[model samples]
Target: MASTEETKTAQVRIQLTTRYPDIELPDDPGPLLVSTGFRRYALSTLVNNLLQTERPVPFEFLINGQFLRTSIDEFLTANGISAETTLTVEYVRALIPPLHVSSYEHDDWISSVDVLSGSSPAVREAEEVSSGQERILSGGYDGLFRMWNMSNEVIATSNAPDEGGHTLAIKSVKFISPQKIASSSMDRTIRVWDYSEESATLTPTLELYGHKSSVDSIAVHSQSSRILSSSSDRSVGLWTTKKSEAPSAPENLIPKARNKRRKLSHPTPSKTGTQRGPLSLLTGHTDVVSSAIFSPTDHTVGYSASWDHTIRTWDLTTSACVDTRTTAHPLLSLAAMNGANLLAAGTSARHITMIDPRASATTIAAMTLRGHTNGVVSLAADPDSPYGLVSGSHDGTCRVWDIRSVRPGVGEVGGGQVGESVYVIPREILKEKGKSKAPVGGEGLKVFGVCWDKHVGIVSVGEDKRVQVNKAGDIIRT
Candidate 1:
């Protein structure tokens, strides 16, 4: 019976393909047959042998839009697929798990994070070569934003409220250029700053006054000089980085919500820079707008995720809400998958929904990614690949996901696929390192923001008031 069963063991046929231009096989190599026991390693070795490369490169394989994590026989059995069918396997460079490198402590809860890589567009345009150094910018609940160097040194700090900085906690921040920074705050204003690295000075350049409620987040298009901000007032503000291009605030402008005045660190006359107004105010969301971002390909189009349980598409050229897609839960964060034509929205329901915002698309959601134990608060698109995405959550972890590895919803009511994360990065506890740093917030370690940089693998900030760096690639040295 054992020998009879062995005789019945099937051989599967596969055809390999890749998007990588340099790494490829013959156009009509024909289908190759292999034993069902082969896994990723065995298949990878086979490809390298065919390429005849001096060095072997690790490869990941995908079949029918999902990664093949199991042996060929096991995968076929689990999916009820037949061994007689020829599989088209797409191979790509395997991504290594990110390693935790360094952490910088802050005074209060860190709300947002961004990175300016050595090879960023702003740096490249200046023709300045960075000696493998990247700058990190962090916004805090302490009503301040700070710039840090690779050595964990504080390079520059924003002024206090009395000295023209935000009077309330900053909610979002971004590096507009090497010399410019932008931040939105609970004070209901967006401030642009002139950063002088040589002098370690951060001076206020412009104060944008338009939103009637606290500004929740801000997105910048440096090349176009445009800024998009989300607010609790249920509107998105569209503004410019240049003051000369902005019009004066309407004289009839009124506050939407009443706020209390708090005692400042120093009571003095306000020095809050030059004031300006938004180019247009986008209103459509019925609930608090948590995030707003420009389209990955088209700057004239924008998307916003809100507590109203809807994701809206806006025509920036006409200041009109063009389309909206409703979801089951409130959305808290959003990011764009460049070249993939998809938007990822982190939801209060503890999962990220992959949305196809195209008008001609029939489905509301293309897929759903799950694994987080708490609300996913923030998301960052991978700079390395269009199919990759990273999310930070209140569950005290950041999850790395590959959109390509998805399957049809097993029990999901929605007519879409579902994906699981490739990796989960947990909050690093200082106590584990023999250091005594107590975490803040009721949950103690919820990640509030996350960003992926070309040079900086992944940067995450949380209720622990720490900016943690996770480095990937063989070239990164801690």
Candidate 2:
């Protein structure tokens, strides 16, 4: 029976062909006829050898009885077969499997947000208090001085008493104490206000009058009761608080500039009475002094940027000029950072210059920023990120710049390589669609101020009569 079965099986022979014309089968039938117990095993071996025969496998297939299917071409491709290359398998199992693929989708909006209010009517100046809360004192064209309670929702607005006066438009306001506020106005006087404990309301305490011109700016000493005010009269005046007393005669009001040759000349009364005197007269600039700020780190030192196209550092104790730099154009605003060592000034020329007060008073013109098409009106620095700065421009936009990589050059105070920008907030340009139903002459937005609150993020005020609060580039509230 065994002899009859072996004769009936009669050595099954097979020949394989591939799409690669160079691959060939061996001429010797001895190796081909070696009886591997499984017919599929012998077929798989032949297919793998054909794939490795120095020719690429255009396609792969498996054959068993009358069925044919594709195989996974691992031996040929090693990594995996791709769409461009076809793979085939040859096998004796009577069936083949189908090829399969898989399919996938991304998101748009920002993930999280934190919102806080900006100073209303556009904050003219903002200062961070030691308590981690911000003291943002703002002046409005409406002749009001408002103090925003950043810790609460409702902002406290207060007006100085009329005091036989009319329509006092506040031009500048500064915080002297938690209980006291000082403001300068078109009224040509500096009024100090005392706040009620719980009500957060302000009442006029005293009206100081020495500036011959309208007081344009005010700065207070962090440690002392003294106050400094700059005026359009081209002068900076220092004031000290005093208690009221009974009225007295106005005598000795003129000065006696006498000659030695003249005998026994009567002295003229001094024009400036004992009521006030400027500690020192800073007279370098020929134009109106616009802004003056005391260094937050050093009480004895301060800086002033003026419409005279110059910035000067002054020693408050001696009232002497320490350093000065002349701008190509009139400066509109000024900011000092890193303990007043690095100074930034914005000009009417639409350029921003960085300076080092301790170094030579030369402006680092190469470090100028030219993004704003209109004049830069204000600038603020991040409390946590010293290199991060936010600027508001008349072009109706606010931009954030990261200047962490900027470094000063050798022997140059503020002369350093320009930094790369990490973020920028573009101006929201409004498009006028058509003539129908549109207001006669209404233009779009105009940004008046931009400020960064440690607790609040970035806040911007515009001429559109809106205050926009943004956190991480997205407008959280308007």
Candidate 3:
């Protein structure tokens, strides 16, 4: 009689197809005889070896859309799979959850386009034009704002008239409509330009000048023509777009497009200014307010991050500050996540503090994320991507953090007392192309703005004067 192991083994015919396109493998290779063994690892190895051509590649197996992870015999037995059953399995590279980044998978990411450099230093911010994905707007420290086509080339070249653009370093840029854009600058003024509609050279239809200091950031309400702008003046101002007389500064607003100059007709003013002064100035933070955003869930409710080491939520209906709480570190940036019901705030300590706004009014972070070696100054929450949040730090790296993997545990570091009750989540790092990933670090070009979309991947700009767009994700092996 055969030994117990041999007696229990099943003779299964295994048909294989690689799910990873980047890690090349054979196409339609003949089936192999796989004996379902007591050891799951051995069966996994047999399939992996046959799927790989040059070297064995790591993979996860699924049979008939059902995932399999343990010993083959046990799994089959548990699933009521018979000994004579033929197993058709699909082999795929190991995967990190969508929107999440892993240290193990930078090789799969490719810089789809060569770095698109700007005319200035430190590309401060970037946003995809929602009306048309073909156009992307990039703001810079060189006091220039340029629009690029889908190909990453500057728009309005050789053919169409360019819009009225900023003259000073643009601190914030937001698209109000496909043809309309609002940009705030260090020049202490905001311009609302008719960016795409008219045929003639584009110029500001309205210029907003109310904030006493350079505006650091701006957010537009999803439901109305309202805007919230945070300034170095240590206050957040709320403004609305009211019908005004013709613009008095139309001539001053229009700048000669790069390499192409077109004179614009002085726009006859129906309004004297681009916008009326603040509907209400949210004043409380003792230091510069770095970022303010309308809550994605409720437009009337919004949050602001300040250098005062505090985050404040205000009621826009009354202009009243409703909640205030101090954080663990000086706040530099903020990204409000609706899906997770969490406020992701970047801090001076090279860490990210996620707060449950639904929690009591106390200003405590529910959990903290650490990896960067310098202050984290920018954060972008991928609404479509539930697995992660992207951060840009002073260390010149844009890191994607997988929040889905964080769990509560007990541990102590940095002089903070840890009790058995405290929950601790371990650390993860962002992987970079060409460079080996640091055990714990971010990846970027001395970033100022970081944004990611399912289709666009991660787009970052910084002191390097170049816009970097990385198509990050794993490819299937053929």
Candidate 4:
């Protein structure tokens, strides 16, 4: 019998295939024998050699929907795969990993982040500028929401506590328009602000008070001026940014008991705007509703993810919950991938689950992405591609994922296959002062929120009180 090394080096048969329209291989090439010792780089070289192109193109290989991160021999042994079986591998253009660009410091933990650039609703497409106009909106545990320019200067900040600003830690923030913003907080309310870029000022315009408990997150639809909020009270509230469009608060919906306001150093601005209420309350979640967002393709359709381990689809026009898909772990964050007709949910189990919320979808889940070492707390869909996604986790790392590269789950989760991240982005040390010098994987490094802007790249906030920016590489369309 041959030695262990020789047996491990034995060749295996593999069928090469690609879904990419541009890349093609010889028809009926049959199976090609390759050493089981081949890793990703070696396999990539093989493909480039076959193509015989002037310049070698890097490619990523996928077997069974999972990336080929290890040598063929190691992977086969670990999965108990037999060499006699012909493995079909899919190849696609490799994505360049995003590099750390810059970071902004905060007084306390940053909870949520969003970037506003020329692509925002208020900014006309014709007047849209790539640089200088980019603004960053961040909410923090310090009970203040701030607006920063591309130069990392604080252009505007929320009003004083007495002036209708958040009385407690802000949980979420979003730009309703270039001139307006909406924020939700543990103070049991949502607040909209009027921002003046010329004067670099932020003013409290409206106070939305109706949630019985802390408001966890908020999403905005600028076209319809609609806002969706998820709360600890287990309900999703619907409202409009335009004051005149919303109705009065119903007496029955407001709770009899309320959270006591916390005292602050600055005198509150004396409640500047009219207090408004939600147009409708969609209730069904048995636990805290962590996130809510309107469908990208249809404004009337909405979805909410809750700690109850379920994602509920709603008919917003009727204020009805149309369907619910249960998962194995509590969901902490959610993002819409309408281009792909899917919703991605970040879970406490340290993985992101992609669900097919469409009524005609045969399975509850399309696939599961596994990589994060801690709870996945935030998710942002790549604005350029439906299959592209990024997730922030308590493990102090952000992972970029391509849902298309996935493998079958073999029946562990209902209707769930599995995949791994395309790139792993880690927290970087800021060269500027007042930044954390904590080592990689240090404590108190949990990433709380993340958002991907087409113009500004990826922005993520974490317990380290830093708003980190990473410049994503150009997409190599295959």
Best by TM-score: 1
Counted clashes in each candidate structure: 0, 16, 21, 7
My TM-score estimates for the predictions, one after another, are 0.90, 0.56, 0.62, 0.82
Q: Scored by CA lDDT, what does every candidate get?
A: 0.86, 0.51, 0.60, 0.84
TM-score leaderboard ranking: 1, 4, 3, 2
After superposition, candidate 3 runs with Cα above 4 Å error: 1-133, 156-167, 197-201, 244-275, 359-363, 407-444, 473-478
* Candidate 2 per-residue lDDT over residues 386-469, each given as its tens digit: 555777666666666644334334443245444433355533223223333212222344455565665456655545433445
Q: Please say which candidate is ahead in lDDT: 3 or 4.
A: 4
Predicted structure 1: lDDT: 0.86
Q: What is the per-residue lDDT of model 1 for residues 1-478, given as tens digits with 9 covering 90 to 100?
A: 1133452466799998987777777554778998777889999998888888798888889888778887888788778888889999988878888889899999999999999887554453754537656789999999999999989988899999878899899999998888899999998989999988779899998888899899999999888889999999999999998888998755334223323475323322226546789999999999999999999788999999999999999999999999999998999999999878999999998999999999998888889999888889999988877888999998888999998888669777477989999888877775476744333322788999999987877999989899999977684121
Least lDDT summed over 10 consecutive residues: which range in candidate 4? 262-271
Clashing pairs in 1: none
Better of 1 and 2 by lDDT: 1
Error of 1 at 24 (Å): 2.9
lDDT of 1 at 150: 89
